[model samples]
Target: MAKPTPLNLLADLAQNDTEAATRELGRLQGLRTQAEQQLAALNKYREEYRARMQAMAQDGMTATRWQDYAQFLTSLDGAIRQQGQALAQAEAALLTGRANWQSQKRRQNSFDTLVARAEAREQAAGARREQRANDEYAARLARAASHRQD
Candidate 1:
């Protein structure tokens, strides 16, 4: 069996876990902010395209106008498709980041639990050692008192 780490060693692990959790949480937050920004930008582009298409329709012109509208519609379709792909990619990245954060949290919790258990065991051992020392001192005092009387 692997030897258990000494109680003194647990402090380092606890500190490391705390630091890791903080870092992972920060990373997750950053990824979420980036994803939201990308989605917002995509929506803005789609809205701008809608406005332009409406303005073009109001003119009501000739064949050349129809061709221009067709070209505009095709470009709009491409932008919408690209936006959808980007949104999907952003969502996937967010989900992966969330999972990574959750995994880190679980590791931190495990380390915390281990450190607490180790500390409790160390405290109990210290108490036992103290009690034994006290008992030995009392026995010695009793023996000295008896010798003095004799």
Candidate 2:
């Protein structure tokens, strides 16, 4: 048998598993990053809005205008709270995804190690067989020379 080793199971199965997990991890990272950026943008806008309101209040704002600003700030707070929850969920999902990828990678590495060891053993055995054949040929030549001398 020329290609005797059936050592591609890891590439077929374990590698696929690891690759899928890696992709999942990447998606989760993107989601988490997006959530964080959105939250930061919302917070920054809220800060700027508040500063504007303060300046208007200093210029003697109308009561209706102040009430409108207060209502909008309340809505903004709700949006911020929802965004915070979304970010938390994204963070949790990313953590789980990372763990899954690490586990899959570990399994793939273990299988790769086993395959490497098996190949090494096969190579060593082949070397031993070659050495034996060489030794046998040398012995035969030496015996032939001895017979000739006798």
Candidate 3:
């Protein structure tokens, strides 16, 4: 855990934002996958139905039966079109989610960089203070030794 400095607080917030974005991206990916699977199944079923209708027609169906098959095929085509639109929307959402995640990640990285630089600066300042104390101690020892000799 980092100390509760302003920089650390900002970094924590950035981390949280990034995590949320990642979760959203995952959800969007799942939706896109589902859409793709559904579309594929619908296409496969439509083709199978068409094949069956062709076979039945070759065997000479009644006019009424023919109309039923043609009407059903039209409905299936509409379903396919609707499914295609859903898939396209899912893809668009996924694309936008990815961009959001990337932006969040970049923001998190920037906060991390700022925190690192601040820590380095603090450490350098501490080192300077220690060096100054050591120099002062040495000078005191030298003066004491000369006083004793006198």
Candidate 4:
């Protein structure tokens, strides 16, 4: 049995790191989607509120009612902005995770290439040793036949 190379161990570690990075990227994407959904819902609700306010104005709303509606709309806008920021952050994190995964994959591939080269070298060496033994055996057989004839 051939002894294991350090490259094999390094490759295993790199594979684990790559898998972890992939999971992290997936989680970030999920968070970004949730943030987007919240932003969409907030905008939809704000539009509905504006429609209701318009209907109220047609019926003649009080000044105090107008002030309250304006304040609530402002708060909704602020929430929407905050959600947008969160989504941006999540997207950035996802990009970073993807980069890390790619780096890990590259490292793993390098180690794997090294391992393959080492195995090929070992196989070649074994083949040479086998050929040498066959040649030595043939030489011995020829000498034995020459001695028998003499």
Per-candidate TM-score against the hidden true structure: 0.72, 0.88, 0.95, 0.86
User: Compared with the true structure, what per-residue lDDT tens digits does model 2 show for residues 1-150?
Assistant: 225446656545888999999999999999999999999999999999999999999999999999999999999999999999999999999999999999999998988787878878889999999999999999999999999999
By TM-score, the better pick of 2 and 4 is: 2
Better of 1 and 2 by lDDT: 2
Candidate 4 wrong stretches, greater than 4 Å: none
Return the lDDT, model 1, position 72. Answer: 73
* lDDT on C-alpha atoms for all candidate structures: 0.71, 0.92, 0.94, 0.87
Query: Tens-digit lDDT track for model 1 on 47-107?
Result: 7866776787787657787778678768767866776676677667667766766766676
After superposing candidate 2 on the true structure, give the runs of residues whose Cα lies further than 4 Å from its correct spot.
1-4
Which residue window of length 10 is worst by lDDT in model 1? 1-10
- Full candidate order by TM-score, most accurate first: 3, 2, 4, 1
Candidate 3 least-lDDT 10 residues: 1-10
Clash pairs, model 1 backbone:
none
Order of the predicted models by lDDT, top scorer first: 3, 2, 4, 1
In angstroms, the error of model 1 at 59 is 3.5
Candidate 2 lDDT trough over 10 residues, lowest sum: 1-10
Model 4: ten consecutive residues of lowest lDDT? 1-10
Q: What lDDT tens digits, residue by residue, belong to model 4 across residues 33-136? A: 89889889998999999999999989999999999999999998899899889888888888888888888889878877888888899999999999999999
In model 4, residue pairs whose N, Cα or C atoms come closer than 3 Å (at least 3 residues apart or on different chains), thus clashing, are: none
Q: How far is candidate 4 from the true structure (C-alpha RMSD, Å)?
A: 2.0
Q: Report residue 22 deviation for candidate 4 (angstroms).
A: 1.4
